[model samples]
Target: MNIIALKSVDLAIIALYFVAVLAIGFYLKRFATSGQDFFLAGREMTAWVAGLSFLSANLGSLELLGWAGSAYQYGILAAHWYWIGAIPAMVFLGIVMMPFYYISKTHSVPGYLQLRFGNGASGLSAITFAVMTILMSGVNMYAMAVVMKVMLGWNIHFSIWVSSLTVGIYVAAGGLYSAIFNEVLQFFLIWFGALLIPVFGLIETGGWSGMVARIQSNFPGQDFTHLWSTLGNAQDNPMGMHWTGIVFGLGAVLSMGYWTTDFLVVQRVLSAKDIRSAKMAPIIGSFFKMAVPLIVILPGVLGLAVLPEKLVPESALQAGQHSYNEVLPLMLARYMGPGLLGLGVTALVAGFMAGMAGNVSAFATVWTYDIYRPYIRRQAADAHYVSMGRWCTVIGLFISIATAYVAMGFASIMDYVQALFSFFIAPLFGTVLLGMLWKRATGPGGFWGLLAGVGSSVAMFFWVKLNPGALAIIALSDHAKPLAEDMYRALWSCLINVIVTVVVSLATQPKPLSELKGLVMGVTDIPKEQNVPLLHKPAFWAAVSIAILAILQWIFW
Candidate 1:
């Protein structure tokens, strides 16, 4: 409440950011004249550029604040999202899955589905992806406005309009080219702006040890500092989750679903210059992902140890009460002074805009290529589609702005939108995983299995919503929390998808082996990477990344 509005200097710094990103968009518009250029960044991005953009695409203000809030609520258990929920799947994407995606030469994930299954599966996947992107962009749009209202006391409507319009202008002008470059720039801004919180919070708390002692003293009988120590029993941890939920549900299903199959992040890898670059992009991203908990989760953990006033839940926030999600802004107001505060605000603003840009860019691609190309206007010229893609970006932003306003009325906006996204991801991953690895996975099998998988998830969601008592039955334990419920839901949906696909495939006529060329794994002639130098190879770096993950888990345990 005591935080001041942006000073003249801060306003100047933020203004420069808008000018810079707009400049990048306008400058690249000339280069992104073709469909390939606008949609895929001309497939010219080297590993490092693609890698940073891949990581930054998901580093939006909402992700940072929400996860930081998670740390405050659940403690070090939040790191599992960064580690178990991300690392292994990302490495698997780079090492195993990237080959199938890259070699098939599919424009989008749904495009890959179309080649492997048919129009039925592709249409289903594309439409769902388009809807998911719009909702997610709206979430990012709402997050930007929330940050502005919280820190500078700006009007929410003004914040939302300005952000959506700016993001729209750039992404519409240059498509993925604009989005990727801006995402890379935003990555640097985020680290510079947000890294200060953990640094100053540590100084106040003495260090990690002091913060641990303070949290332990504040919440007696709660296991808040250890990552895996109390995970054996659902009742032993603050998260109220067992290790099976962490390992099988989250680490296997949700992790693979989001990291490997979610098109938003995977689109960045699709822009890499070559196979090796595609393979290496996610590998590079894995290393930086390991460090994100330091900035995101640590700040919330620090807040639990040091904040003078307790924060409320999102629905409980009203009048003068601060929510857990407000911890970042509250900490900025507390420790940061003058110019640094401006940088922090700019970082959040950048994050929000870039998040919207990433979603809109991916939406434009899927809507134009996956949806419009095959269904609406099958005979359109490449230039016409490029024009349509540009138009789709602007249309998507308008929809996102509307969704942001709609989000204002909901108490559980995040949960509802996130559940919509989760409904498709785990099941879609199951379908794609089977289509790639199994020779017997027929077209009808993929379609019906995917629909049934998504249908079951939807059924389960409403069943729990209508009767809260059903959560204990579904999650397998009364001690399971809302987060744990999601993990179990994904695992169940994925399992159902795999089972249905197998059952249906056994009964249907199969596609001949001659027709399955680059699409299926066993039949595809994948080029070997053993000849590449060890330092340059993706497998070597992936191994090193796994080694680092193990060491961190052991230390945190």
Candidate 2:
């Protein structure tokens, strides 16, 4: 993976892109007048910028690294994640959840929780989100660092720190404005670089038909054409693809949680000029989601066909590990020509930086608004808050760098990272979703639900951690591994949390109708027409047709 002798053109591209990102940060300084402006870009993001920014933030380096790994192991089931988990969830969030959110006029999702539930709920949600962001950011940072180390032969810790500083400088300087602008650039780079991999792999393997032939010749009866087959099986039959798990487990739960409740995403929508833009933000991004399998997941499938047997290190095989998330990077080094490899690596870095920028901005917002302003005395002026926000960004960057170093110690960075988030997000999403949609949901119920959900999730995390096989029906089965056990524990705990929240909300007296009237009625003092334009009939129908076509393509192809 020697990348040290990068071409002058590639180095120039990387350097110029970095400079452009920093320049954008400085260019947006004029917009950083008030706390709101710094945090939400004065609610002035355009639909295109919002859409690209939302997609780029979610595309983080972990996705590029981890998804390819998942595809290598799971075949088409990996693609099912985006179709099932992300697409429908985003659609629901846009049409149903987002309208209510925009009408609420709250800056943060947790702020909306406070209005719907109570201060306790808001505080709990904020803590959960902040913790998850910190942990996940660290994981993303570590993943990017791994890429840097492998591609450039740099020290891992040095790469981690360098990445942190590069992202922090721009985000601290420009806040949401910088994050969004840079995201647009990053999105294009990521899309281009990602698409190049599979195209090149297909070309190397002769063509789509040729690749299929080679796969059949090497492993006969394998259903490589179906985007829903297992890589290996015990009974000489392809394993069931777990379409339900991809749709429900990954798509519905993970994608919906992100599109609806995650502050990183909600912040983008909040920055929209009006409600219409908010609604359109996610819809526009969903179009990009439709392409992710082609750009990210399909490369791994192609890698399985093109990569030489000895390309993967013997150490990896001896560990009983088939999925090395680094497969994409390896493929780029081995297969892609020099110039293309550089562009692909640059795209990887761009995605990493975009994610880091988003996290830094979100961290600054939470620290300055939720934690700092509320608790600290002598309320700071707009200028002072902005300064504090920058400082907080710096501090957060350091913490992420440190955590990335720690995460490198893990056996599998993506598994540890995702599992950590599920523990917090599953319960938190349940509480937030229940509080918002159910009128009977009481403030006390929200509070208690937060406590119960987090408590149960944490308890289950530890229970599975200690016993390992305690939840398994049979002793020491394949399902009893730590990662699988943790996922099951988190899933069950989330379900329990939702049930408790709903049951308690129903059993108890509802919030006063008067108190709940504002949210229930969906009334805002702002005139409805002031919002962005709704999708016209033709556009709406076209979008629906596209969605259906995407699903059909997945099914039939």
Candidate 3:
């Protein structure tokens, strides 16, 4: 708890890192002269920058804290949440979703929705995305604040405000360009900082063999021994630990939702200058995702081996209590020397800032393009619209900071935030997927499907809240408790939504075939003359190879 007393050098490094991030923001402003440049990085990002930005935007303090707490409580089974949930979802999105999305040339997902579905569907989805992004932004801010509070001994509110303001200033000034540029820097720092904990942890515990021996000696028959087995069962394992848990916990749910559907990530791909870049962005990031468990989750396992009983403290036994979220911070405090600790702390701040910037940029895009442009006025100059976009960024940052303050009351910010998203995401994804793939899927169907999915997800959420014990019964009958509840509600809701949308759209009267041509063809007015051949060559295969390597790591490592 007295971490600050041990590392003045580390704190200084962290301070310098913050200054560098702000500097990067200012430097990127030159490119952000127009609204498109500000919101979408002028559609000129390379595959690597796009990829890193996508990863950094998605990887925030919440992931660091959540992974640590999950590993602490559940052992190895926690890794599944990332592997099954995120990686495949991302790959699928890149291969399947990006080509069409890029072809559409829309600025945001909701912008695509309007073109594909209609004004009603696009408006509703945009509003939903905006709300979800705002909520998620707050959750990320709250986690970042907690890290700052623990590492720097700063007041939580002040830390949140400072972090918010720093991110807001640049985002408002330069928009997505600033966010993406900072993201590239933050991604490396986060990767390095994350990697260091486990490296130092291994050294502190002796080595991989020594760490394994210590784990076996102390917590015999635990699945934490293998990385693959820790996916989903991280929270409730009776055995030492199971790789299946890792597969499910990290793999299935989290990965699928985040990689495939989340606007924060897809926005990066959508902003790419060309299809090849979009395809490669998530593919490149997948490698980073694969490497994360080694840096993030392994430390928790190492914590079990290295920390004295007193350090873990009993209060920390609960999922969200005693700041197990501080696992990385505590490990850095314990093992890192002064100057290095400052660098590590700086990396942490960078990760948080990158996440905030990404969210702010995404929020601004949604508000300005999707909501503000359509409803507020039909005609506005590009300059005027661009100025309004900056205002939206500031407004979004304030809303998120305020929400972060409210979220501090929750015991587990990650769980609360994810649960909140689940209510809307399931339905939204259902509608989007259907709208994209199914030609018969009408606007009414999309709208009703979303409504039905939301209604069912909400009803199920309340049902579980009201009758906690019933969940146990449902769990026994169901393969998974949390997933079962979610799937049951989501699937049924989607089914109803899809059915209603299809039936109504067909029955009410289909739009004329000529009118439907644009929607069905998935074309935009942008030039197709200069289209680059889909990079279905060796580089594409190499990207695929890296993704396979990631999977293999999950399986074997």
The candidate that wins on TM-score is: 1
Which residue ranges in model 1 land beyond 4 Å of their true spot? 405-417
lDDT of each: 0.87, 0.70, 0.69
Screening candidate 1 with a backbone cut-off below 3 angstroms (N, C-alpha, C), the clashing residue pairs are: none
Clashes of each: 0, 3, 51
**Residues forming the 10-long window of minimal summed lDDT in candidate 1:** 409-418
Clashes of 3: 51
Query: lDDT value for candidate 2?
Result: 0.70
Cα lDDT tens digits for candidate 3, 167-206 = 9888887789888888888877877666778887887778
* All candidates: TM-score: 0.98, 0.89, 0.87
Candidate that beats the other on TM-score, 1 or 2, i.e. the better one: 1
Off by over 4 Å in 2: 1-4, 216-225, 228-244, 310-323, 409-411, 471-487, 507-509, 521-546, 549-557
Error of 3 at 236 (Å): 6.8
What's model 2's lDDT at 331?
Answer: 72
